[model samples]
Target: MGPWQLSVSALAQPDKISHLPLRWIRGSRAVMAFTVSVFLSSILSVITAANPPYPPSTVIRKIVWAPVDTITRKAAGSDNLPVTWADDEAIYTTWGDGWGFEPRVPNKLSMGFARIVGAPGNFTGTNIRSPAEQLGGGRSGRKGWGIISVDGVLYLLMGHADRQGGQAQLAWSHDHARTWTFANWKFLQFGLMGFVNYGKDYKGARDNYIYSYSHDGPLADTPADRFILMRVPKNRITERGSWEFFERIDETGHAVWTSDSKRRGAVFYHTDGCLRSAMTYNAPLHRYLWWQQIPVPKGSADRGDTRFEGGFAVYDAPEPWGPWSTAFYTERWDVGPGEHGDFPAKWMSEDGREIYLVFSGNDSFSVRKATLVLAQKY
Candidate 1:
């Protein structure tokens, strides 16, 4: 087996010691104990060498949320909001299946781009109609899943070019999302990709790489068994060949990346499953926050109306490819957490305790205030 490969049974079957010749050691319990210890240690080394100690416990005890804030003019009648803070001191975001912001569009747009100005509570959005904007939803047009700004240019991750579960492409705007140039390449295998936000113009990023994540399946609405991660040098995001997929972790707990997509491994696993996520780095707390949507089960009443009501989960980690810990989770949130959500870095408090959550509830853009109760220091 390769160095990165591990047999599940090797760690699972710890009691299978029949292969050891106990007769040689005979009544010497000390020798027997040392022999077994060595055997177990070898197995543990192999396992740790192949994978990180995942699902690490969190420093956040829990998240306490206030009621969803009432919708203001700009946020109403839109959903699928993927946002990024630009260097120009404004938040740029995308909206789907609605006329965006005030003075609304001439007709409903499948996807539209807008720039938000002012603070979170008092901000206003102005639609920036672009020739690149898609006109319809679902099969007819594309869904905007992720957006990021680096060095004054804005990049958008477009999913569902053919279908929601089909393909994703990168489009960028040099003029603050006013005009875009689409990349010719398509992410053929990874259908839905969400960018990891690192504050204004990628300022607080841990490294030079821009990270992204996707669930196991192609469909964005459907739950997947695991989440996959990928990263590209911040300067080469549009170059298809520069992207690398996460494969595994070495014995040092450092991430191993590969250019080969097929060799990529899972970064996160959820028994209850997860969908597209909103991720941001909290510089004050030095943790990555992942706001993931939990899909309702098939054949259930909630499944048909998840847009209005369903489940949502929040997790935090020390890195983008996480040994994640749950910060908040609920099967039945008071209001539907929508299909998409984001915790814009600009809205976070200096101490990283108070924050605002932007999501689509009742099929409209919504905002809610939340407080983080951190684990007490020893």
Candidate 2:
């Protein structure tokens, strides 16, 4: 089917009430209104109960302008980087073709590095790798790109291309950055080049669940394709993993997944190309979904361009898969000097409290921390 064909007719319509009587409708209308209101309220309550929003217990902390030790000062290089804080330390990955400012540099390689910081209060950085060491000799070994942390473990997702083929791989670090377990790195199926992005919701004090997104098939150029959501079981690692596939979009799209901390835990993915995102909570609204097409702000540089950097959406659901409410959609802030290209985003902390947005353009990259504070309603 086409991209916009997600079965959206299931959502209830209140406009149907207009067909009722006009004059005699006062008393009858009051009773009917109460009935409809009660029915709709019941449905909303069920949805909220199934996919509640994140609790206040999940505190959000912001870390900005975190210092970076120059791994390589190439006049022709761009610093399009991605960063994540795990185990009380911050990890960064840089990617780009050696160009403008940093050109003639010999070891023209993209790289990934880790730094162990004491805390947000203690922001001193330590260099984890050097340019000569990161370059190596591969043509497509540009650099590591995607970074995320789950259950105290660090994961890096990146791609490399050679005469053989190009594929994305996953690497894990157990003891922070001191060591890494890069064994059977799961490569993306041939022709697919992207990394898995993740999200989580906390239950009680120490329990929670994580979800990751990845896909297989028609490659980059194809328009009609579906992305798969793999719900990573708590503390388990293996390909015998359980995953579900959402219907394919007729074109490329971007999504942000968040978990609702209720029963079965709901997951909501906001897909861009289709101008809508779908939510998979329980069995009833299981098929029930909600979405809103946020237009690019007028007169902004992103007016006609859907690919503008830094555009992101975070949803609040009373339960997991949701009838979620849009918190806010903001224009891309130039984290980099000029244009910071957008990359996949991840929740820095649980409960949609804080979002870590990563963007890269040309040679420069940056990560911004956004908190979902109560937006002042006019």
Candidate 3:
């Protein structure tokens, strides 16, 4: 946090400045060294990475690890799912294809479903028997969704992209993950701009509605879009009329909510994109934890390390419509670019000290899961 070294050997000397060490003069009398402090500060920022503590151990699970050169076998796989549900019985994940983009046909693809029984360490991994089954109409964009449970009901905030572009819709499941019944309704209209990629969905005991979010802009793993927010009343899942758009918070510190769906705005903006996002309420910290898998590209604008720009980052905020701040971040992850990283609610602790990170990528078989020790809250 102090006393960083700056090398000026490679820097060109300024013309007008007089001081030997460097020009400390004001106005246009500045030299090229004017930017030296700015460069060094950027270095210090990476040195002082605001990363949460790493987990004690990282556990890997394969929902369907099919070798690239398989004979008569098709590895069961579906790794990307913003909708992750967990319980004492089992941990359930849905959406995305574990098979990747193979077969190239896209004709027989189904929304992959999987289950990990027991708990994190003692989990049974995947049963691996007939790992995937068709969900919905199997339309290409029908699988993008954000799911949350209010009381005993589970709500799925599904998004789609057709020839006409993007849109968002809703559905509910009463029998856990065994079956899903889609609401004959539209949450966000066809031309509603963002909220097309609802990464994480949340419900608060102190609040009356369920909150949802999205990160859609430019491309995946780069600076593009911010975290967009939306919500619907708990009592009105069936009533599309109950959905409300989050405008912004007022000066007095109260959240401003309105029924006009077109009022949607990005509560938190980031360049990270192109995948599912995970969110949950951390009771001990009194904040929301947003876990997103952002692939730091080769020429990505570096916030810290140029070689490694984005990976899985933990962003914390006091409100759902976040005045959010970074709690922890990393430039390294096991999955490749455009991959997704997520934290299942059950694997996270109430104090925000420990977490299990899940990673899934393009056309791979296994889903990489790591149990990371979160940085102790300072």
For every model in order, what is the number of clashing pairs? Answer: 0, 27, 15
Question: On residues 1-378, what C-alpha lDDT tens digit does candidate 1 reach at each position?
Answer: 332233577554433332232222344442343334334434543454222112223478778888555443355678888888899989899998888888788888888999988776688889998988888666467879999988999999988766644678899999987789999988876666889998888898998999989886665556665788999998899899999999975545567899999999877776435567889998899989998887777666333235688777788877787656557767678877787888999889999998888887777667778889987860
Candidate closer to the true structure by lDDT (higher is better), 1 or 3: 1
How far out, in Å, is residue 91 in model 3? 2.4
Score candidate 3 by lDDT: 0.44
- Choose the strongest candidate by TM-score: 1
Clashes, model 1: 0
lDDT of 2 by residue, 1-378 (tens): 221222323213222221221212253343343333324434433444322121111111121323333211222344434445454435434443442122233445455453523322223334343322245333334445445566677665454533122455555666554455553645445222222333221112112444443323222222112233444454564342332333221122222332321112213322221121222121211111111222244455332123233343333333332223444333443322212222222223434334333433224433444444543320
TM-scores for the candidates: 0.83, 0.46, 0.61
For TM-score, candidate 1 versus 2, the one ahead is 1
User: Worst ten-residue run, lDDT, model 3?
Assistant: 53-62
Residue 153 shift from truth in candidate 1, angstroms: 0.7
lDDT ranking, best first: 1, 3, 2
- Name the candidate that leads on lDDT: 1
Report the lDDT tens digits of candidate 3 across residue range 122-163: 444442223224434323434544555545455555555331
